[model samples]
Target chain A: MIVERKSVDLGELQLDSGETIPSATIAYESYGELNEARSNAILIQHAFSGDAHAAGVSKKDGATGWWENMIGPGKAFDTDKYFVFCSNVLGGCSGTTGPGSTNPATGKPYGLGFPFVTVADMIRLQKGLVEHLGIEKLLSVSGGSMGGMQALQWAASYPEMCASVIPIASTHRHSAQQIAFNEVGRQAIMADPDFEDGNYYDGPGPGRGLSVARMIGHITYMSDDSMREKFGRRRRQMSDESSLFEVESYLRHRGGQFVGRFDANSYIAITKAMDTFDLSLGHASLGDVFEPFDGRFLVISFTSDWLYPSYQSQEIVRALRGRVKDVAYVELPSSYGHDAFLVEAGEQTEIVRGFLASTFKKLTPVGAAR
Target chain B: MASAVDTAVRADFVPEVLGRGDYQIIGEIVADGSSVLDLGCGEGELLAWLEAQRNCKARGVEISPTKVQKAVSRGLSVYQSDIDEGLADYPDQTFDYVVLSQTLQETLKPRDVLHEMVRVGKNAIIAFPNFGHWSARFSLLTTGRAPKTKHLPYEWFDTPNVHFVTIPDFEELVRRDGLTVQKSFFLRGDRRITYRPSLLADSAVFLISK
Candidate 1:
């Protein structure tokens, strides 16, 4: 299916940091039809560097969306039965207001002038777009990695608007190690002389810095087993100053490809938001954040994901179970590590499809079998 | 390797429409619209039945990845967890019934699991194959080897059942622990056994409360 990106102009977004943007435009995409009752709508959040074009061939680039395998006519999200929506986050550069967007006051790119955005702010803006689309309640909200964080924030902030949540290969908060990794990515960007303090949009920009950051990111996304199986000790033996080890070359290629598509400023802004996320930051306990939210939870983790380990997902399950809340969890078997949630869509499809169907049945029980 | 032959001979113990007879008994024991938690709920077959027929809100804890997938695919709230590691997090009396059907003997710490079940639910329904049956004892006496019966069909090396208990042994534990036995049902194959249940019955189900 060929899909086009749509935008909604939500004027004036007063952020949680006491900062206000005069005008905010959210770019999004949706599949399937919203029923008369509007209960079949499901909002799928995007991970870091992901855009609103979650599924289908984009009209602009004609490239397939990131999660195209998982959301289609008969796929996991099941567009035939669900009106699935994906929106670019508040601090994203994919047609959403971000650091690359023009500043209304100065008539120039906001760059360093862009207000800090949190994961909370991203979902808060998404809430406005959801309401504008006339969806009173979502059957479920789901995503992987950073996208999972947004789904969790939605359930925490607006439990009344969601029936269930499926947070896949993610954690409720960033550990010290997670924060450390983000710091390395941020430092790489700032160290580049060409960065020019986020004001390099009109110049060559910090392409090398961003590429290094992405190379580090790609390492964390894979497992030791996957690396050995895919690249082994093979050498590319390239003539240029390019990488020699096949794995190194692969990372360089991926990083080089990513530098052209993503903004360095958005990378800094989003990673900081992810590093700062803590569900129990203000609450008395992790259980306290879920005191008012009485929705079912499906928390999934990958067996080899050392970055977001299974133990972290266990903490969320343990907290919910301590409060006697309904929660289900599964540690999927995968050698792909954190990338399993994206590439191993077949394993996730059955559970997500069932979870959504049950959530819908719970909300609208008409004609459902006893 | 010859376990398939044993399984075939014990076809009476095989699953029926609602799964095993123990599941049907569990379905009867569970109250309508009540909450239930099944420990070691393999693919959540019983819980799904309870949800569909009794309108119960059912959840489960299973360790097998494939089984957990099957359960979740059926829209059952089954968490992938080791039972020995779980039940500690669940609040007191959270479920009306905590079912441990046909999985008690396989646990590493059966006694601790039993106590945790009682702690987490108002009632616990336990089902286990009776190792004190006449057929098993006869096999042991005649063959002079590790006895293998239809209900307990495995060689010693491959058997998952670590701690086997009979009806008498279980009742003694319950009595020593000061737990009230609400009900008990003994069975041989698919039929109920009432005469000298410990000696004649191949399996037993007990409902206990503290």
Candidate 2:
């Protein structure tokens, strides 16, 4: 279906770092109609590099949303049954107020001047958008990777806002290795001469550095087995100088593609946000963080996902075991590692569809809707 | 695959009768409106049956990821867990019934697992193949090898039943553990066998409480 982008002025967002954005505009897209009772509303959070266009053909780029396969009329999100909404997060470059957005204070782009945004901050902005839509309690909040972190934050920070939660291929906290990988990407961007201290909007920008950073990030997204299956010891055809390995060529292509669509500063800000994402940051334990959540939970993980592995999802499940009454967890076997949630949509669809169907049934009993 | 669809259609008509194998009998035994925790609940067949037939709140713990996925797809709350690790997360007598159906023989420490199940639930329902059945004894005598019947189909080398116990053996363990057998059902296929169950029954189902 042809979906259009909608924007809402969130006024001023008091960020977690004691910084404030004078005016923040959140770009969002919606599918289906919100029922009269507004009980069928579902909020889908996007991943690290993902945008507000979660489903359907994007109006701006004419490309499909990242989760297009799973959010259609009869798909997992099931637009026919539920009103699904996805918003570009705070510090996201996609139509949202981010590093690229013009700063009202200096009339220049925020760029490096943008204060760090945490997963909690992103959820707060999302809450504003949900409130703007006039939805009191969301039927569910779901997402993968950074989006999954946002989903967890929503369940923890605003426990009563959503009736159910689905956090797929994600973790409650970033591991030391996760932080190190993000650090490498950030250093790559900073090392770029053309970065111009994040004021390269009028210039060529950190194209090479951002491309390199994306390449590094891309490797972590895929498993060794998937990479091997896709391109083993095979060599790519190149002119005269030297032959390129198939995997090397693939990484280059992915990195080049990423640089054209994404902003460098926003990547830095978002990754930093993800690094600081610990559900039990100030709490005594993970159980204490999830104590307030009284919703059905579906925690999914991929077998080959070493970045945010199945063990990480198990940690969340372990914490929620006796704490939450209704929690379902599945570690789907997939060759595609951390990117399995994106790549393995067909398998995910069945699990998500069943979960949403059951959760909806519990929320709205037979004849209760009338 | 068509059979699965047929089963789904059949479930809509009469859910209690739709369950396959021992699950059908287990579904009948579980009380209506009760809370059940099915340990080693492969693909949650029994839990799903319990939910549909008895309108019970059913949760499952299965070790296999593939089976867990299948169970979740059926809209059952199934967790991927090894029962041998214990059920410390669940408080004492949290559930009305904790079921260890046809999985006791496969557990590394059957006694420890049973203890956890009994500790967590008001009552425990256990079902396992009777290794001392007449057919198994006959097969062992004739073939001069480990018995392989409908209930115990696997060969000794490939068998998952690491600690196989007969009806008499299980009853002995139950008595030794200070658990009272509230009810018991011995089956030869779908038919209930009561007289000389240790030699006649292929599988045994028991409802025990401490």
Candidate 3:
């Protein structure tokens, strides 16, 4: 129920090429009491297109959001024990200002005119929000997928701001295979006639193109085993009974559901941001990216997630172990693929609870160690 | 808890803290933070220290129930398993280091246990009192009986040193199996016998890699 919206001056968002977005607005939600010591505050970074409403049933549409499984009273990131914060990214559709929002200067949707944003840029904007909430050092920062990328960036960029980090089902950089997949999705949207070169804001915009794009994304989100188990070649019971393929039906349902809640412009912007997200892109190496992050780390990966496989998590742990053994990694056995972090409740809940308990034990006052 | 543990422990006990001969030999061996599976881990003292000081996690296979209890009480993790039956439950390369310490000479099937150790670990560390020491040679030659020293403090009938091996003899055996020696250390009392340990030392330690 506790939600808020605020626009902060991020100076000027100078694009990778040569452009500038004069201003930006960041939407965020905060819950639980921040302890007096200011160490119990946890920042929950939202994934691609995911809004600040990470928990609770939506007031507008009587439905729960993506991470509703674990961010409640007695959940893993328990609001009862720690302060929780989640915010819409720099370029997102849901409540925060994005390409679909009106430009204060021209009084029209920014569309493609919105400045290109990076994972680092998202972390920078979140820094403003965290400071606005009057929290100094975060007890821990955690998230999955795109959210996981932000957590990694937060720990790498602002090492002293948090005591620990838990990045689930994420990588330090986008692999060539992932970039190609996103590129095809973007191409699908642009090829649509309704796309209108990103200017069809008032009228029917690239819904079909965006739906197809989501279909491609949905395939990657789940594992083959998960799809086979959920929807086999069972006939949909009709006169002819020439039922659609199980995967076809499943993709159609997911695509329709996404199109209902999301904007095509937002998809273009967020996916582009993810494509640009390579933490080790310009850094000396993977190890150097984490050299500054001296805090304890709990990195988890799913056994079935071919996208951002366990090797990526291992790379992060290997880099950290080069410095110290404060890193703990647990590859949970699951068949849910990349989405396992959100769906595999039992495995994630146990690992996170155990990790937090251990981190808290280490971070407890020095006098308590004896 | 500390007082209760202290009261239960016997007082006359002074752990071998590795004499100079043992220390010099063990120092040359790789005792880093490896996944170690130690056989006949007495009191689990060395394993616990390795874990604490070297970040090496270890699992001990001890035959003595009393020693297993003592090791567990000291916060050292251990399992009661037999070595001769082969480490069938453990997969290949399950450990980086498999150590026999000073108990290899006492095993019923030393060769079988050594082969199993090599199979489970990439490398193995073995340490034993040298039966070829000058004192042992003198006793055998003059008294026509097995020699006893401070290091090998047991009578001929009760001694566990059945597989009596010397530095050169152990080297020959290790070479016969095509195993390469990573390092070797000779121990004489609390000092290292680096010059001619085969003839001068009381104990020898060798680190071997298959």
True C-alpha contacts between chains kept, each model in order: 0.73, 0.60, 0.00
Q: Which candidate number has the best TM-score? A: 1
Looking at model 3, give its docking quality level: incorrect
Model 2 per-residue lDDT tens digits across residues A8-86: 8989999999999989899999999898888999999999999989989866668898898889899989999899999
Q: Candidate 3, which segments miss by more than 4 Å at Cα?
A: A1-20, A237-242, A366-370, B1-210
Given the true complex, what DockQ would model 2 score? 0.57
Better of 1 and 3 by lDDT: 1
Model 2 chain A worst lDDT run, 10 consecutive residues:
A318-327
lDDT for model 2, on a 0 to 1 scale? 0.88
Cα distance off (Å), candidate 1, residue B205: 0.4
How many backbone collisions does model 2 have?
0
DockQ, per model, reads: 0.67, 0.57, 0.05
- What fraction of the native alpha-carbon contacts across the interface, defined at 8 angstroms, is recovered by model 3? 0.00
How does chain B score by TM in each prediction?
0.91, 0.87, 0.85
Better of 1 and 2 by lDDT: 1
List the global CA lDDT of all models: 0.88, 0.88, 0.73
Could you give candidate 1's per-residue lDDT for residues B83-161 as a string of tens digits?
Answer: 9988998878988999998899999999999999999999999999999999889999999988798877899999999
Q: Model 1 clash pairs?
A: none
TM-score, model 1 to reference: 0.95
